[model samples]
Target chain A: MMKQKNVNKRHLRNDILLIIVLLLVAATGAAYLFLFRGFGDVVKVTVDGELYGVYSLSQDRTEDISTGEDGRQLNRLVIREGKAFIQTATCPDGICAAHRAIFRNGESIVCLPHGVVVTVTTAQTQGEPDVVV
Target chain B: MRNKSKTTAFMGLFTALALILAYVEVLLPPLFASLPGIKMGLPNIILVFLLYRRSACSAIVVSLLRIALVTMLFGNVMALLYSLAGGILSLVVMILLRRWNVLSTVGVSVAGGVAHNVGQILMAMLLLETAELGFYLVVLTVAGTLAGVFVGLCGSALIRKIPANFLFLDK
Candidate 1:
């Protein structure tokens, strides 16, 4: 019984150690990513893994992005005052629509159901004509 | 022979309980509006319980059954893909960690939770063909770890209530 109690204590220590290690790893990765990212110059949108369009952040416009069959799916991306956000979406969950405006490099609004990803980027994205309007 | 039947009955009961938990999660709104797939992982309590009490095989069985049923009831084909990836990956990690015997149930569950998120992110990257989604793992790791700790605590509490002898014959 004494040995069993000792083993349990060791197990608890290991558990706490494991949690700390994993959390530290995650925190490190987050810090690295957060530090490297900067203010973006354009908003890039992709639908179902394909490039849909790229709009300059300086442009102020509401783009009706349609996807799926007969353009049945839609996500309205609005870029205003150098910030980009989804104003509305036909996606069931509306997760992307609820996302706050993103202006930092690598920041994104993802719509899983619709397979839409709107990302803010500083680098030039290859694909589709850049819509500067 | 009776013992075999008892195990099967218990498995069924646990599966049902996990399904109920999954349904409950569906009813709850998204925990974080921006993070689409970060679940409370209520079903994980049952997974952890089965892992510690019965056998890894039983835990896998229950996990797969829960995912299959949830997909039919509350999700689509895409959802199935994500769940399948996450569930199997997490279970594999949990089983391996449990074998090491160095950590408690909470630690095993925490590993499982993190693995689940990592697996799902991998699947998302494959499906979307964009590595950018990898960034989500940072946030998901934190969420998964917390969920794992919660589920692990619950599983430990449950195990305390009914020791292995109450339900199973000694191997």
Candidate 2:
């Protein structure tokens, strides 16, 4: 009986620790979602080494990028002068629509089904195409 | 050896539960326009419960079978791959942590959630053929943390209410 009690105590302690850790992780995630909004500010898109589209986040305009053999699928990207966002896509997951306008460095847009990427680069950094799809 | 029939029955039941959870989550509305891959991961509750009561091998088998069967029912092969990768990674992490005895079912579930996000991101990187997608890892991981906790809590509750002995009796 004593041994069983000790085991139960250990399990309880472990459970508490687990809850604490999970709370920490969830809190950190919430913080990131709230705090990390405007960290970058440039919009550039390249396809197969060719400059397909570029938008300034500061301006309010939308550009349509159609990629595929005959343009059967449409990938619409919105650029508000300095900010870039994916407005829509024909992909099944519609993942591209979830990306917000990125005007800062290290921010990007990826359409896996369509094989396209749009990235923001820092002004000070050399403009090498970050990704080609 | 005599318990093999019982084990099979338990596995079938868990598999059904997982499939139901997966279907339910699919019905939930998307959280945001900017978070397409995000999900509540309700099925993970069942996975976590299985992990604690059954052997690691059983947990892995269940995870794999659940993904395959659920995907087939939904007709989404891509989603299946993503789930499989994430599930396997989480299972490995939980199994390893189980050795230290520091992690409860919830902790292991959270770890598994993080692993799943990592696995999905890796697959995205590969499929898209671009390292630029790596930036999304941070967001996915952060989301994973929340999802993991929710699933972990659910798993803890489930384990308590339905004793493992009853569930694994057939096994």
Candidate 3:
């Protein structure tokens, strides 16, 4: 009986732990989708050591950077007024499309496969920095 | 020898079943609009079945082969990496859970599904080179819960029909 009870207790404890982990995972996602969506507003764009385009988040506009026919890959970054996003890339993943726009200090857009990055370096808010480095 | 052939055939069938299920799930609508990698993980049913009826080595082989074959046919090699990570992690978690005997088939299946999601997210972080991607974990976990329950139920039903002799065979 004692062994059975112990097993039951262990099972219960594991169930509780699973629930806690699930909640933690859910909470982290909610915090990002809700709280961190609008934390920046500056726009800067650079490509292959050259400035591509800069815009204002307050203003709505899109900038395009094109690679030359020489097949030389271009490095690019875009900071929109106060929000920063990936301005250009030649890498395959295109994961930058998923990055949150950077509006505060420490926010950056990096293409690891392409070795390109766009960083936001000003803190408009006094809380934790927006992007994960 | 005949028994060994039968087991091999069964394993192949299950692997094929998993591949078909994966393709079907991919064609379905997204579970959440913001989450790109959230999957129902229906293919995990085959893993659960192999766990209960076959050796761990067989389960691993089926998992790896299914991932490799499916990715080669319809997806990128990068996707194969994510599936490999998810499959290995989930298999380990299930193996550990199997030891307690306290977990029902459903419970073990749920654990595997959750582990799979966690593993995929970790791989995504490394591939993307951004920890900010961790934000997707929440969505993946919720999706995992639903998928876990579904796969768990399917696993339990599958185990009910498997013969005891087939489960115990060692050839």
Candidate 4:
């Protein structure tokens, strides 16, 4: 690796401008994220577009959620300390595993490859769509 | 004033540096690794350095070669796909921003850093067939921006020291 010598003068202005832009973007983005944060009480796990299981986030347990036709174990949904998260997933992306814990209503963790959707919902809105129909 | 052999040697050295960085990142325990959307983006420093000091084509080649070599040495198929998607997207953005010449390496690296995360998230969304990943981008954007700053500092410091050789830089 070549050594870095002195700093450039013109690049400084642009660098500062870039930093400003990035800080602004990050600030607005943080606001947007906080603005729409959820508050669900129930944790719902769905597999392959169908309802697989529903558990209360208030309780603590380890659930092995099997997905797809073969029913091979793909995700491990863990509920503890009043939050829900995927302890593990055998899927390709592991997006579900990467997700932070969810406890608020409307928060969800999705495993794309296995078609698993773990969502947090209020007791009132739970199954409202099917029941309304 | 530039020798072909020296240029070749620089290219090889950059490629090796990138490979080492990538490998080290993978073996760095699980702090950022377990966090999903969060990454240090240490390897990006070299890419940004090359983009500013060297030619974009060589930078691209080095970036792709680094990804391929790293994936082959220590990653799986999914990792390969993710690296490819992220590396290409990041390089493209950095090249464009650098060409604009309005932004500094910091800005270019920031764009590149954020683009890498965005690309990976998009690929994840496609594989998962869900938009909930959108929620994750908020965190990712923040993480990416911070990582970009770190990479920018390193790249800026390094690029500033390198002797100016206009061989491949002529564009």
Candidate 5:
């Protein structure tokens, strides 16, 4: 009985230690990501790794993003008040549509089924070459 | 022979329970509106229980079975991939933690939950071809931790209520 009690105590301590460690890691990461993030000026949309478009967040407009052959899939991206979000999507899950607007640098809304991703980025550090023919 | 059949029956019952829990979670609205992918990890409660009561092999088999059945019933191919990644990673973490015997069900489940989110996020990064998706992990980790604690509490309670020998018949 004494041994069992000791083992239980050890397990309890381990549990607390593990939880505290995980929480600490998460909190630190969050602090870094949130505190250092900057407001974005442009919304970058990509479809299947290809540059779809780069729209100024300052412009309030809706763009019809049609993907897939014959343009069957569609995700309506709306940029307004310097925030970007998917107003509507034809994807099954509709997760991206439900996602909250993103205006901070590196924030994104992803539609996995449609292979659509909209990211907010500052003007200086935007990757993916501008599609200029 | 009887014990073998009893074990099989128990496994089946556990699978059914996990499926019911998954369905229940689906029926409920998203836990956090801002966090689209956050879930209660309700099925994980059974996973933790099985890990403690039965062998890791049984728990793995049950986890895979539950994911497969859930995919066929309500999810698509993409969902299948995500579930497989998360389920396998979480199960592996839980198994190792349980084997170490340092932490009890709650700790094991907590690690499992965090690992699950990490696996899913990794898979998302790969499939979406976007490294920026990793940004979601900061918030996702917090959600995973909370879900882990809740599921862990339920799992420990379940472990206490259910006896080890209940799944096997004594000759």
Candidate 6:
């Protein structure tokens, strides 16, 4: 009985350790994502594992991105005031639409049902075409 | 009347319970719409119970059955893919933790939740082919841990109420 009790104590202690380890890892990642993140120069959209297009953040415009086999207009990605947001999407969940405007490097909005991803990237350079206009 | 029938019945009951929970989870508005990975993990309670009482193989079978039934009934094919990935990953983590015996039920469940999120995100990355999307991992992990604690408590409480001889895990 004494050995059993000792073993129980060790298990409980390890459980606490597991929780700490997970939270610690999360905090470290959060620091990188929120604090150390840099402002991105372009918004890159991907559809079905292919690069749909790259839009410069300096330009302001609305783009209708069509998806699925029928090529129906599914998601609308808008870039304005140097920020990008999913203005609209035909997905049932609307998760991308609800996502906040993103402008930092490594920030992105993913629409799972529609297989769309809009990511802010550091690829901005002077020679880039002004695609918005 | 034999041992085989008893195990089958137990697995069936657990599978049904898990499916009901999955359905209810879908009916409820997702808690975190901002990120796709946030889940209450209510069905995990059943999985945890199975892992603790029954063999790991039985637990995995029950978990997969629940996902299949839930997806067939209320979700699409893609949803099934995501659930299968998440369910298997979570089951593996929980079983490993249980085997180590270094953590209690709550710890095992917490690990399960985090693994579930990781697995689903991996499936998304594979489907979408965008590696950059993993940036949201931190947020998803945090939400998963919070949900895990709640589900783990429920599982531990339920385990206490259920009879030890119920699963017939031992010969």
Quote the chain B TM-score of every prediction: 0.92, 0.90, 0.86, 0.88, 0.93, 0.90
- Candidate 5's C-alpha lDDT? 0.86
Instruction: Give per-residue CA lDDT, model 4, range B63-150, as digits (tens).
Output: 9889888878877776777788888999999999888776678778888888998898787666655555555676677777878888
The C-alpha TM-scores of every prediction are: 0.92, 0.79, 0.68, 0.78, 0.93, 0.91
Q: How well is candidate 6 docked (DockQ)?
A: 0.70
Candidate 1 residue-wise lDDT at B144: 90
Docking class of 3: acceptable
Model 2's CAPRI class is: acceptable
lDDT of 2 by residue, A1-133 (tens): 9986786578668766765665576567555644674445456675533467555555677777888788777788887656787888887777778766666566778776666788886533435544312
- Which residue pairs clash in candidate 5? none
- The clash count of every prediction, one per candidate, is 0, 23, 23, 9, 0, 0
lDDT of 4 by residue, A26-113 (tens): 6786666556665667787766556777787778999999876788957999999999999889986576787788886666787756
For model 5, chain A alone compared with the true chain A gives a TM-score of 0.88
Estimate how well candidate 4 is docked, as a DockQ score: 0.33
Please give the distance, in angstroms, between residue A119's alpha carbon in candidate 5 and its true position after superposition: 1.2
Error of 2 at A35 (Å): 9.7
RMSD of each: 2.2, 4.1, 6.3, 5.1, 2.1, 2.4
Highest TM-score scorer: 5
Shares of reference contacts reproduced by the candidates, in order, are: 0.60, 0.38, 0.22, 0.36, 0.69, 0.82
Over A22-130, each residue of candidate 5 has an lDDT whose tens digit, in order, gives 7788788777767888788898888877778888899899999999898999999998999999999999988999999999888899998888889988777765556
User: Runs in model 4 with CA error above 4 Å?
Assistant: A1-14, A46-61, A67-73, A88-100, A110-117, A122-133, B1-9, B29-37, B165-171
lDDT at B137, model 2: 74
Note the Cα lDDT for every prediction shown: 0.86, 0.72, 0.66, 0.76, 0.86, 0.84
Residue-wise lDDT of candidate 3 within A1-133, one digit each (tens)?
Answer: 9997887587667655675677676887677655766554444443334444444456544544444556465544444554656555565655565555666533456443443445443334323444311
| True-vs-predicted CA distance for residue B127, candidate 4, Å | 1.5
Candidate 2, residue A3: Cα displacement in angstroms equals 5.9
